[model samples]
Target: MTLTLPPAPHGGPRAGRHLVDAALWPDVARLPRASALRTAVARRIVERAVRRLPLRVRTPGAAAPALPRQPRGSADGLPTLILHDPGAFFRRIGADGLIGFGESYMAGEWDGDDLVGVLTVLAGHVDDLVPQALRRLRGAWVHRRPASDRNTVDGARRNVHRHYDLSNELFATFLDPTLTYSSAVFASLPAGAEDLSAAQHRKIDRLLDLAGTGPGTTLLEIGTGWGELAVRAARRGARVRTVTLSREQRDLALRRVAEAGLRDRVTVELCDYRRVDGTYDAVVSVEMIEAVGAAYWPAYFGALHRLLAPGGRAVLQAITMPHERMLHTARTHTWISKYVFPGGLVPSREAIARHSAAAGLSLVHDTGYGEHYAETLRLWRERFLGRSAEVSALGFDHVFRRMWELYLAYSEAGFRSRYLDVRQLVLTGRTTADRGTG
Candidate 1:
């Protein structure tokens, strides 16, 4: 059923807050508190960032010339961000730095033909934008992670549903035919190389290879992302059993499995990793650990340890942040947690290694591919905009549309700036003393 909502006011003070979808209101209400002192501090931060921004930013190979930063209008055919109300945008940032930055976008305070590109510049200079002295204040603004958003068995279901269950069609419109949502392994992202589906296949193949999955192999997948991994593993003659908390994903994955005539070899169960039973020769989890709250890190890795057979190997693809940043922001509920992925906490490499050691597992090999993830998001964002009409036909309002765009750009910028990284790790139990290559 299509949900029809009165058009949200595009320009006004606080109208955006009132206009955010009902489910998101709770998060908006929690936006950082306003204060004269904080506003003063924010002013300094904003000024520093703005000053550090390159006045002349070049867009290589573009059809137009370099763009002026924060121009009132397009400069020489190149895109420029026009801040309709500079005061309001700055004030929101003053009130709540990160949250306000996103809300300002939702409120239509800024725009450009290349939103992602503009954000990319800012992301590249994130370190210079904020002074080291002021970084300590980040933890001072204490907003505890919501208890209800914990990754307990029951909490996990609600959090997973909040995003994945929106509509398979919604994801389908943006994804390639493979329906893979995570990063693709593009060996060489030439202008006209193999399409995204082929890259996705390569990525899945890498994970399968890392897990040593093959004929008669019993594979246990901790996250069932539309059954792509399971299908690929089964094609290698591995018996696959994948678990997921998403009902929507499970339903469609089962259908896809049956459609491929691998239903007999593959099992798609509506299950949580913490409660998964039995063991397998290989275990694989892709970008699922981010959703496991920090509090459950031990339990999550322990589950992997217990489930892996003695000679079996495990492959995990995780999104990671810097250890210091992770510790500082782990407890805060940011725009991502509130609007897109609830109860999610990205782990740092240090955290992962520590947890794995605790779980009696060794990180034998690891590889980093942050740039590939940025490209993946860039393609998805372009595809999303190309299918805007279809998206609206699915009942998403304008505010919802802007929110998704910002979410995609935000993630892309993080990777482009080296603020975020994605890793593929191979793990094995450390039975005799210890062993690790990473």
Candidate 2:
């Protein structure tokens, strides 16, 4: 059955005042004394971050935005700050810290002339922006990834639905023609030395190469993202079985596969990785592990280990964070986990190695390109803003649009600041990695 989407309320239920009332303002109104204290401590650190940030501020075209205490500076590449409700902005941050900061944008409290540049500065100093002593208190003030969002087959379905199933049209407004959702590895940058679709193809081909996929190979793809990779694999004469829990994605992917004339070779189905039984020459998952909650890391990797044929490689494209940061932030649920991706966690390289090793997989090769992600985000944000009207036409409202604007900027900043990274890792059995490939 094809699912029909209702038009967005301005931008949809995920946006507008409903979102603020349901998610943001509650965090505001219910700032307990304990949380406020933490927010206060957080404020001290953020104030320091702001003071030391190499930022330049100026009136927009000799006219400042309708806000007070705006900083004035020259034409350096620094981001220009614009504030609407300074007190509410700080209050939001005081209560929820990072989540509040993003909510402030959604609530029209502040903005930047160059949102990405401003966020990049903040993301760069994120580690230092919060006092070290606060790590001990994080457990006291933060909400953990909700138990309901767990990666049990049923739980995973709900979590994935919250984000991916929102509306394909919503995503279509931003993503390039390929409908590929992961980071695109570009070759160069001048006037489009590499476009998004091209970069996506490069990223997929590189992973397939790592897996040694070839004509007549049997391949298992853990996450079927709109079917681009599966289509490409089938085009190479590889038989592919790709699984996803997202009904919306599965339906569209099936259509795209058939449209490309590869239905015989590529099979897209709705299935859980744990229940999937197969032995394949190659296995690949792209940026799917983030959605795999921390508790399920063992099963997630073990499935790969069990599925790979002798000497067969598994290539996974995953987003990673610093080891220490990962540990510090792992137990705490922040804005991204709550709003963007429920039950999602970005693992550190150390965590990935530790868990994969425990699950009988060994990492043989790995590559990271955070800057490429930043570039990709920059393009997506620009494209979305360009199509802002079209997005509204799809039923998204003002609040939803601004929320996404901040979401994109927040992510771009993470990569620019070196706070986050994306990597493709080639793995095999420890024994296989130790021996030369046959």
Give candidate 2 misplaced runs (Cα > 4 Å). Answer: 1-44, 56-77, 132-141, 190-193, 430-438
lDDT tens string, model 1, 300-319? 99999888877678899999
Question: Would you estimate the TM-scores of all the predictions?
Answer: 0.86, 0.86
Candidate 1's error at 319, in angstroms?
Answer: 1.3
Quantify all predictions' global Cα lDDT against the true fold.
Answer: 0.79, 0.78
Q: Rate residue 369 of model 1 by lDDT.
A: 93
- Backbone clashes, candidate 1: 0
Q: Give per-residue CA lDDT, model 2, range 90-169, as digits (tens).
A: 55666666777776677665679888888887777676766677756655546666777777889899999988988889
TM-score of 2: 0.86
